[model samples]
Target: MIQSLRLATALLSGLVFGVGLALSGMLDPARVRGFLDVTGAWDPTLAFVLAGAVTASGLGTALARRLRRPVLANSFDWPTRSRIDFALILGAGLFGVGWGLSGFCPGPAVAALSGRSLPVAVFVVAMLAGMAAHGAARRVLLVR
Candidate 1:
């Protein structure tokens, strides 16, 4: 029952997120590319979108910390990573390159997949391959 509830909540959250992305023009690669084009016609509209997201996320996180236990889960699962490592830097750099080149990060990319564009499909495939490679590499490299 708990797992079912969690799954339902996850699906609902994804639906909400996809709707927000579509409404905010985040699902449009042209809008994202224009935002990144600071040297050219840089569109700062998405900056407001990003700021709103940060603000809402910050407030949500603050409220979550005040709770004794998660409303659905037994406890909060906060991120445990404390140290910045080489993998973190490399991954971030790669993500920026991919975003700048394709104008689609993971969330927006997945949302944009509904359009059925060949480029978007290829990007999603490449993104999944990178994620798989990262996990495999981490296991091999971290295990000594």
Candidate 2:
């Protein structure tokens, strides 16, 4: 019963997220590039998308902390890491560079794939490969 509820919630959340990405023009790589262009024809549409996401996340976080346990999980299981570490900073820098160059972050890239775009497909494939490589490297390198 609990597993079913969790699955249902996951599906619903993914659907809503995909709809939001599509409706907010986040799935468009050209729009994303425009936003990143800054001095040249910068688009501010993504700012509204960020604002909406932050607002929703803030409210959801506040409500979640008030709960003793998650509705679909045994516990909150939030990340333990809070400090700004070297790995975190390096990873973020890499992510930002990749997002800027490709005009597609993980979520937007995945959502955009629904349109059957060849570039998006290639991006997703490369992203998945990178993820797999990272996992393998972590297993061999990281002690924690």
Candidate 3:
């Protein structure tokens, strides 16, 4: 019962996020492209969206930290990487390129499945393939 409730809450939160993204014009490819093309025709609207997201996420994390026990887990699994390395930089560059080309990040891509976008479907498949390949490569490298 508790597990089902947790899953329902998570799904509901994701649905709300997807609706917000769609309503806020973030789901439009042109808006993302405009934000990236800051040299010719700079559009700073996405900056406000990013700022608001960061603020809300920061506050939410703070609140979660104050809780004695997490509702769905033993504890939070926060990343310990404080310093950016070559792998991190390279991965980020690749992700940015993919985002610019497809205009559909992971969460939005899944959310867009209901919107009948063929290209989003392709992007999601390719993204999953890349992730699978990365995992395999990591396993191989770690064994050697």
Error of 3 at 140 (Å): 1.0
Per-residue lDDT tens digits of candidate 2, residues 72-135? Answer: 7889988898999999999999999989899999998998888998999999999999999999
> Model 1 over residues 30-75: C-alpha lDDT tens digits?
8999999999999999999999999999999999999999989889
* Models ranked on lDDT: 1, 2, 3
lDDT, candidate 3, 25-131, per-residue tens: 68777788888887968788989888989999999999988997788877788788799899899999999998888776787788777788888788889999999
For model 1, what is the error of residue 73's alpha carbon versus the real structure, in angstroms, after optimal superposition?
0.7
Report how far residue 9 has shifted in candidate 1, in Å: 0.9
Candidate that scores best on lDDT: 1
Better of 2 and 3 by TM-score: 2
lDDT of 3 at 98: 88
In candidate 2, which residue pairs get closer than 3 Å at backbone N, Cα or C atoms, i.e. clash?
none
> Each model's C-alpha lDDT?
0.94, 0.92, 0.86
Relative to the unseen true structure, what is the C-alpha lDDT of residue 136 in candidate 3, on a scale of 0 to 100? 100
Clashing pairs in model 3, backbone N/Cα/C closer than 3 A: none
Name model 2 segments beyond 4 Å from true: none
